[model samples]
Target: MRKHLSRVLLVLTIGMCCSISCKKDTLNINYGAITEDLSAYLYAYTSGMISKASPIQIRFAQSVVEEAKIGSVATNVIRFSPSINGEAVWEDTQTLRFNPSDYLKSKTTYIGTLNLAENFFQYP
Candidate 1:
């Protein structure tokens, strides 16, 4: 009878130890936050066809100084492969908007590039 009690106590102790050591927890994921250690495109953005009359926007990781020369500098920043006629403006300190004069031509793919090597593109 004592041996059976000892065996039962041993099993109960082992079960208690296992339960205490192992814990069930939940993980949270942030969509806006960067997750990859090293990525080709670090910042997540949507590509391909954009809707009509919808302004194209560029978002920077950090805020920039929008100085007096920003108007001229913004124009030269974004360039399209097929060439697009648009007015570039600053939506905010970190966001730049390219508003096309009219709706973009259908079935046409526009390749845009951001030339951020200028002096006005400095981060503070």
Candidate 2:
């Protein structure tokens, strides 16, 4: 799990998502002062993943807006294109995690786009 988590993040920084990887892989940010512990925690917790069944997490300095739209496929207002079907479970009040129902598929290449942008990061 640690190895897969490490390979999930393309960019690591406190603020700003930097760049979202555009790919044909599975799906997967953040706010606050974002301490070192936070970054380390996210990597261990997996900020994102591909062809994997890890939960993607995002930490906010403040609470996230439209928490209802975040991880729900039907009511998601966060708008991740080709929408990800998962449970919107919270690790903490400020941390929102998205755990895909079944992200690992042998031959199926899952394509996801967030607001028209695609991610290209992956791991074996």
Task: Please tell me which predicted candidate would have the highest lDDT against the true structure.
Answer: 1
Q: Give per-residue lDDT, candidate 1, residue 31.
A: 21
Q: For every model shown, what is its TM-score relative to the native structure?
A: 0.56, 0.36
Runs of candidate 2 with Cα error greater than 4 angstroms are 1-51, 64-77, 104-124
lDDT of 2 by residue, 54-82 (tens): 55555544443344534333233122334
Which pairs, if any, clash in model 2? 21-119, 21-120, 22-118, 22-119, 22-120, 23-119, 23-120, 69-77
Clashing pairs in 1: none
- TM-score, model 2 to reference: 0.36
Residue-level error in angstroms, candidate 2, position 80: 2.9
For candidate 1, lDDT tens digit of each residue in 14-85? 221110112243223222332332121223232434465567665554465555434443657666656778
Model 2, residue 85: distance off in Å is: 1.5
RMSD of each: 23.6, 12.8
